[model samples]
Target chain A: MIQVVVNFTERTYNGFMKVKQKLEILADAAKYDASCASSGTEQRNSRNGKGIGSTTGAGICHSYAPDGRCISLLKILLTNFCLFDCVYCVNRVSSNVPRARFSIEEVVQLTLAFYRRNYIEGLFLSSGIIQSPDYTMEQVVEVARILREEHDFRGYIHLKTIPDASPDLLARAGRYADRLSINIELPTAAGLSALAPEKDAGAIRISMAGLRERIDASKDKTASGKCPPRFSPGGQSTQMIVGADASDDRTILTTSADLYGQYRLRRVYYSAFSPIPDASPMLPLQSPPLIREHRLYQADWLMRFYGFEAHEIITSEHGMLALDMDPKTAWAIQNRAMFPVDLNRASKSTLLRVPGLGVRNVQRILTARRVRAVRLDDLVRMHAPVSRMLPFIQLPDYHPGATLDAASLPARLREVPTVPQQLGLFM
Target chain B: MHTVYLEHETDMEGWRYAARQLIRLEVAPQEVSWCVKSAREPGIQGDIFAMPDSRSGSDCSSQEWAISNHAGREVVGISQYHGKTDVTSSTIFPEQLAPSTHADHLMVPRQFIELARSVILHQAPERFYLLYRVLWRLQRERGLMRLAGDADVARLHAMTKSVRRDMHKMKAFVRFREAIVAGQPRYLAWFEPEHHIMAAIAPFFIGRFATMDWTIMSPNMGMNWDGDVLQFLPGGKLEALPAEDDSEVLWLSYYRHIFNPARLKLKAMQKEMPKKYWHNLPEAELIDSMIAEAGTRTQAMLQRAPELPRRKIIGYKRGPQRPDITGGNE
Candidate 1:
């Protein structure tokens, strides 16, 4: 059994007493969750009906990190203490980080307070397994349950999944949470066991597969106008801790490729390893390069928004992404034979592969292309970055293939490396 | 927009296309806050009319599209990105374009004002959304019979058109200086609005350059700097700011200093400042050459360009400004 510090036996179990400390510990623990993006929801507060808030997303969302991504949710963890010492966790039961816990009431209070203050649009809560999976699961579920049924907090709530917890508890959790996530520690089952001994990879998969089935079933019921029961209205998401284990970039990306195919997840966050205290001998001494995390995000964008597949990205030594250039650019440079694709005629999938074009840009091209044959001027009119995109794309008005030779393509694409972290002050 | 909402999802494609056209027509209402998300499949889950697609008005389809194949799906002139009610609607166009009004019900007079302009002038699709909205409310609220008449609508339309022209000039002509006079960074830019309404937009520039001692030089209509003085251009040549001076070299240097090559989104940048504007400013030549050689110069965005050798003393001349007579006061 795990222990609570400052002996709560003397103070009693009423959660409100520890409400302040709960916010501190829980918020820190939740920061590592990568699935807080608020890009795609429209649900609002039923000011008249049983709810106190809304879920319409807004602003730079604290994301758009150096790599231009948004940190969307009020991302935080429930408690960092744990009985099962995951090697990569800074707050593992074996590690020396300060720890705290909130009773269900305390968590509910913090979320309501924060929501009322307009600090976050929603709450994303995860926890370190304390005492038992069942025990931690019970606490996390109650917070969501009370928020929905009692407080009528209708805002987005993304709850972390306890893989081995019971179906009964998990099902109740799905009822209130906008989304649920289970960290697939690394790409493969063996990697999971090696880094996190107590965690069961098979159990994790079973839970994910079960969540998928429930999400699909509920979606069907809702579409048919049955309202059978709202189950994960925002759907399921997962995260993989990159570089914690000896997994190569190809292996990690391949794992993501498989998960997307299998689970129908809304997203998969790639959290690069943060070195833990009293770290295991098997783990590396340092955190992976922040660039690796960035490259992975770019690669992830390729798969989701840009349309690149696993085999297209997997390379030999680099295996994943080049630290300096994005995966798409690196791929383009390697496949010089495919240069100067005619933007007017290229398929939507092909247009997306060009470095400067985003999903929205591709859609615009499709819309504009149908109206008239697109010219280089049209690309500029559409606000497509002709600078980066010029060499790769062949427009009706201009062509760079004749001028840009292979020997100098690298120089043409180079820029002084500006770390994204330094740009935070302006925003 | 309301009819489209009531129509089945499969039959609303035409409605969607029309809405995009209407949205692009408006000059302002900056950005409409659409609920790009829906809780339902096909990703649209809310009541269609209430989904913040366009302005709140009488369902035009009831009168106009009554003959369409589907009775539903005629969402015209409704604010889509905001919400069902005026209280929550995010007008798709900027505030300068789509001014907020009572969101829930139609103010018919504004609609008439808009309808009048469209019929009278055959307004382009881009400007029609705003005029339509203005005229519709005028008709509803002020009474259709009491319209300021055909002359009034024409005058308002012309006013709106001038505002549009001036905004483009403000974006292009507004310049800033980097030279420090005394302890402060002195800045200035020149403009020549055809309408001569520099005073109306001075606040925007003031808010943006809150810390600088700046002057905005307009040809024939002067705008001077210095706290105690507000001097107008004592009428000069109509061709304003047409010459090359050394200051542009320093301006481009400051611009290059802040350009983060890591986050270069050329389309976004060019969308804000197009290439055509590059000719008048000295920096334009350098930027045009750089962008032209984009394929090869992606690596060294800054160093690749020759830098202005650091000057030992501050430059305070550009055909000369009224120098501060502060020595006499001291």
Candidate 2:
């Protein structure tokens, strides 16, 4: 009797320990992909008391990892075992890293447990290809199926779709997930062929096009004027691994522009390549400057919001963005002829081009000018950077004068102190 | 000078009632003072029924207020206070004290009401006075809210922005720990919010975690939901909740592993998840070590020579194969 009791306790301990170990390995493997947004989905709630989750159309960052990334979801892989030998991936078959595979039930339980404790908004499930593309996609979809159907989860779910999966499987994935994404892997086709030989650039594009079509179809009303079944209501997004290849800033931006234009993607995430445990020799030894990734994001935002085209953003002689100043400042310096815009009368698009005036401040200026003349005090009240906008905008109380034509303008603008590259070890 | 004492800090109804009455009396902004009745010193009686003497004529020059309020009858304008009669008897002033003998119109821009709703949640004691001053000016300055350059409007916007941020942070940072109460599972959390937003954010929590039995306790208030109704009670001590749970170990592991050591941006993390929230977060304990070891870890990865390929890389091969029990995908 004593022996049986001890065995029962030991079995339960091992079961719990196994989950902890698997969670550590799988989450570490999946950290390379950088799409953690949980917002912009259909608003849902558990107010009916049938489920235990809700989404407010605005993503909430439940926690921030030490890497400064948003920890909004339980981002993990079903398994860290990959058959494909992608040089940039840590889970390539050749890599000698510890591997783990979570059972479908384990992923469901983990998601519920974390969500119940307010630890995450929902689950972000991705996995390495096992058996075949269909099988792996099936397993990933099954996790969502259980979460949505059996548990009646109403929270956000972002599923990473495999390009090689069938359209039927992808459709089912979209049905269960709030958002779907497929990693573009690399910027250029040649770079992808060289590093990740197994992943087909053509196939990825086709999958994205398919997703776009379905997403569009989902928004249309049927003949009966009834809404069609939802398909990735939050829309599809993709990620490109920056610094993995010799792609320049211009090339990266151009590729992103094409992705946005072609697929109508909600977002194109740029992930700075960091070192892995068993990295390939084919890849660069050092990670690219983190600022490079930051600049790309800034430039990407300009395209999406400020109406700046890709070619116009990278007009500098070098293909790389200037490390000293932001992409907007660089663009403004390059196009000095467009400066000294009138804050009281400039169009919304022109005002958006001003270096320091954000979308919100621009809107405020537009509204304030309607009621009364906008003055320098108005900009100050709006928290607009006075010195930064002085050379770019004209108001009734303040004018750029020769500041826009001054040769020292760029240097003066760049004179702002740069953020330290890294923090001290002990401090 | 007339003083108006509200019942609590977040008494928007009381503030609205008193402001309307003051505006009806044509009381200058400076002549009226706002105070919370409970916050007064001991033995000091709250002037809850203090009403300024009524002016002889309405002189309600605000055309927008008249057009919107005086659609059918002149007496209906005073009846608008009937809905808010439960707030205080002062709101239901005698008809003889009506600002206008014909039509008593006291209305500001709809935008002002929304701004005051958020600004009133701020912890600043001067918030009520600022709001009242803005309301008094809005009656005259129809486009006052649009003039962002005005000091009162700027202060209102700033206070509203702070309250909204506090509410958002409360939503983002509240961490629940699982516990058993009366042999039933319940999730409990303790947070210290910067403003009087406990009631404002309760609906969000209730809507999200409706099916579960949970309670979010702060220093001043507690919100409890038990699958059916949400109840607001007085705050409780942190000791009443569990310090840790079994799931925390898993959460900490996920936090540690998900962090990319090569790219440490402590500033970015701290900016979003400030030090004030670190104590309540279970994963914050790992941040220091993660930062300390990041440089060494990245350096080691950079210095370590790449291992030779174990086998000649094979092209994509598709087949059905059982997953390796111990490790690899094959």
Candidate 3:
């Protein structure tokens, strides 16, 4: 059991600074981790708005982590201060951004304040590799241990792990956190060597593998046959800096698929890299296509939930995902030879391939089709934007065998990126 | 103290409706108490009793007098909920739509409920609302990323409470009940939701009852006239009703199924929907035990062990699969 508080040499460094200045410094530094979920726990106020509780905040934004759970997390870093220079990161030791560190008490205090005020439902906490991996990991575990044992808090918590943390520290973290993520930093081992020279990919994997072992070990039932203390019960997730490496969607997706198959990871977050505030000409001044990030998410979803394989959707000729039309639509246009699949007899997987047919819509069609053949009007009722699917699917009465076109599909759907290459938005 | 806007039914308010019934009970003048607050408050903390403006014949009759004497003038947004309870139930009032307690200082009029029910489902700038909520979810909830060190769950708990401060107006005040008028039964309810949701959600009721003529009353607000124009009213009091109950079972069935299974994370679910709310709603009975025994039940289901369904499986499936209920949410 954790003691109520850790008796640190209580340090109070007050910056007679304005809140906005502090926010500007903190928020700018906090970017990088991505896990925005306000779900998994719901508690309301007792009466008269008298107590501290809320189910009222906007909880969880659905972004795909690699294993493709619409992983939501409170993605922020503990402080921008770093002792190592990892090129892909803005918070690298050499960078000149202003840095601030939150005391564990202050951090805990802020989370509860925000929670009671209905600003958030959970905490996603990550930090720069401070003092040492073991020390930093210990501080992180202490927070979780205290939150659980001291406050009896049952809210969702996701921790961004430090590489090279001790096995004992990781095991303790598993007890309080709902999910733990160890950023791969970049895709290939060569990329890590070139960019973050001090970072070791092997060590990172070893930590992840260690986490997996402890998580597995904790699941061993207690002597009474009850489940032992939980270990990241929400499961493990990781992030990959999208544009930092030469990896394309296919390569990235292939790696993601392998990670999912091997680690049984809950998600893989693809964060499109943004140029650091300071100069580094070795890195591209231009941001990677943010829409590419969006497309990657779509393709990722398809592979995980919609039954599309990696190669079927990504061909060499179409080296990247289509910027204008969705990858699924583009795939349909290219595979016109398979067009006009009969909606009446199509399987759930085939129906999912049809544009405008979401999983929910597919379920509706499957159930409805069993009772009666679906006509275009019934499809309309299903809110299946028939125009999008019409060119691809064959309804009961209409068949468009001649309309399929594999040759012009690519040229018809090229799109220009919308924002600064980072995330497709001008801002 | 909260800023409330009390609404009245053109015909009756919870006050008038209950006054008529209290006229039937005879007892020694016992001081009566009524508690009320925006549905958002905790632990029934906002309850206030009003002693009537004057006593009728006896102590039991002072139910209204007691309520008004306590806090008749202080309550605001005292809108109506349309649900009804059996008269024999111990408390004469429920936070439901029907006014068991006849204190206007505490309860909303039926018309306020009608207006509220009319627009509860109308769409609004949900994204704008969502954007605000997302930020709260981030800084306030998950903490600005605490992986390398300590996390602050308490801070997250505090920030999440303020996000939906306005939703309480709908939950405590929504009044749904069945009533008959001009020889046909109409399912009607009243509420005082802040945003213009009536136009969006009324269709849910309309989709269910395309042929019925019912008015939803929201105080100092508007009401929906069946297939016609919306009716608006200001501050309101009490009235009585000749009522109906034809389609309640279908509504109950629909409510039972709207829950998402994959997202059935109870903490998340409870955070979005509080337990105090269960007392006033009909479906609470189905979920309460499920919530209490949630972990054990979940493990049992996962193990394919013999845990029972929420209710006995008499072999009936429920769905809101009407073909006309076409649109899905964003």
Candidate with maximal TM-score: 2
**What ranges in model 3 sit over 4 Å off?**
A1-23, A39-75, A216-224, A406-427, B1-330
* Best-performing candidate as measured by lDDT: 2
How much is the lDDT of residue A158 in candidate 3?
Answer: 77
- Arranged by lDDT with the best first, the candidates are 2, 1, 3
**TM-score, each model?**
0.55, 0.89, 0.54
Interface RMSD of each: 26.6, 7.1, 29.0
Ten residues in sequence with the least summed lDDT for candidate 3 chain B: B2-11
On a 0 to 1 DockQ scale, where is model 2?
Answer: 0.37
Q: Against the true two-chain complex, what DockQ does each candidate achieve?
A: 0.02, 0.37, 0.02
Residues A1-427 of candidate 3: C-alpha lDDT, one tens digit per residue? 0121122223321221222244345545655554455533323222222222223233443222111222333344556567666776766666565677766755565554333222234567777777777777787777777666765555567787876766567777777787788878677788888988767777767666667765665667765577666687667888888887787777788877877766677778787775445534456555675567778878888888899988887854746777777888878776767767887898888888887678976876675566567677766644457776766778767875655554654554445444445664545
- Across A293-357, the per-residue lDDT of candidate 1 in tens digits comes to 87887888788877789878754466757776778877887777787788779998888888788
- The superposed Cα distance between candidate 2 and the true structure at residue B56, in angstroms, equals 31
